[model samples]
Target: MRKSRKLAVLTGVGLAPCLVLGLSTTPASAHGWVTNPASRQAQCATGTVQCGDIKWEPQSVEGPKGLKDCAGGNARFADLRDDSKGWKVTNVGSSTTFNWKLTVQHATSTWQYFVGSTKVAEFNDGGARPAPNVSHNVNFKGITGKQKVLAVWNIADTANAFYACIDVNIGG
Candidate 1:
């Protein structure tokens, strides 16, 4: 069997210089996390915040379905569970748009939005692959002050779901 290739090297001449490409051989196990208003993982992924190994694979925070915790119960990313890690909080108005960045698109079962233990909204995809740029405008009209919204992407074909926690100062 051939080994999985995570990196591909390429060389160019004349008009362009050499370039290196990063690739994932495994398709089913990779993809996605909330972005807009910037989820904790998104911030680490972009260098806007410092973190551990999660900084390299923010889209890989997959844990079993129905889990309520961020980092998706993955120990390597347990830093995401650190409430005092100084995650940058984005100030926003009500009815905020939650954007998802997909590194590898896959069939999705549902998208859930939550504030603490309270589920604010849910969108059922019925096991359909999502659009390239996935986003949802969730109503936050009744919510106020500092809150952490947990966004979950349930994969249709797997027992796992990707998790992200977005810190926000709602109604600010």
Candidate 2:
């Protein structure tokens, strides 16, 4: 009985580090589906936010439609709006550049970026089905400090298709 007890204790001790490592290695993503207990919906609202169906993995956006659906009505409005909050910069050091990777479902869809309600950038979908990945970066020079950055998406001729994500970053 004593030998068996000693073996068990030794096995547990050996497994402890592996357990800790496994728990700590979980990937951190900026966006994806999020659960809201209050409304019982996967939503990103005033207090609670949902990341939508897209998953951020391998330093790239993954999962269905990704950032594309965020702009057009092809994605559920709730998902787009909920995931909009992830595109912010939490810190700013001097001059900074903002980069975005976007995927589109329809060529008619388009995207726009705004800084404090000011139009900063825009992209057209070019009417290509299975639209190619689009990337855009904007540089802001002389960033004094941290600021609330907002990126908004607008689909042409589609009502209720607009979504916005807020990030705290420099020159946003």
lDDT of each: 0.87, 0.40
* TM, every model: 0.82, 0.38
The CA root-mean-square deviation of candidate 1, after full C-alpha superposition on the true structure, stands at 10.0
Candidate 2: what lDDT? Answer: 0.40
Q: For residues 93-172, could you state the per-residue lDDT of candidate 1 as single tens digits?
A: 88799999887777999999999888889999999999767989899759899999999999999998999999999988
The local lDDT score (0 to 100) that residue 78 gets in candidate 1 is: 92
Distance (Å) between predicted and true CA of 55, model 1? 0.6
Candidate 2 local lDDT, 1-172, one digit each (tens) = 9999999999999999999999989664333211211111222333244444433221122222223333333343434434335433355444334343333343345555555545556566654442233344544444345443344333443442323343444532
How much is 24 displaced in model 1, in angstroms? 13
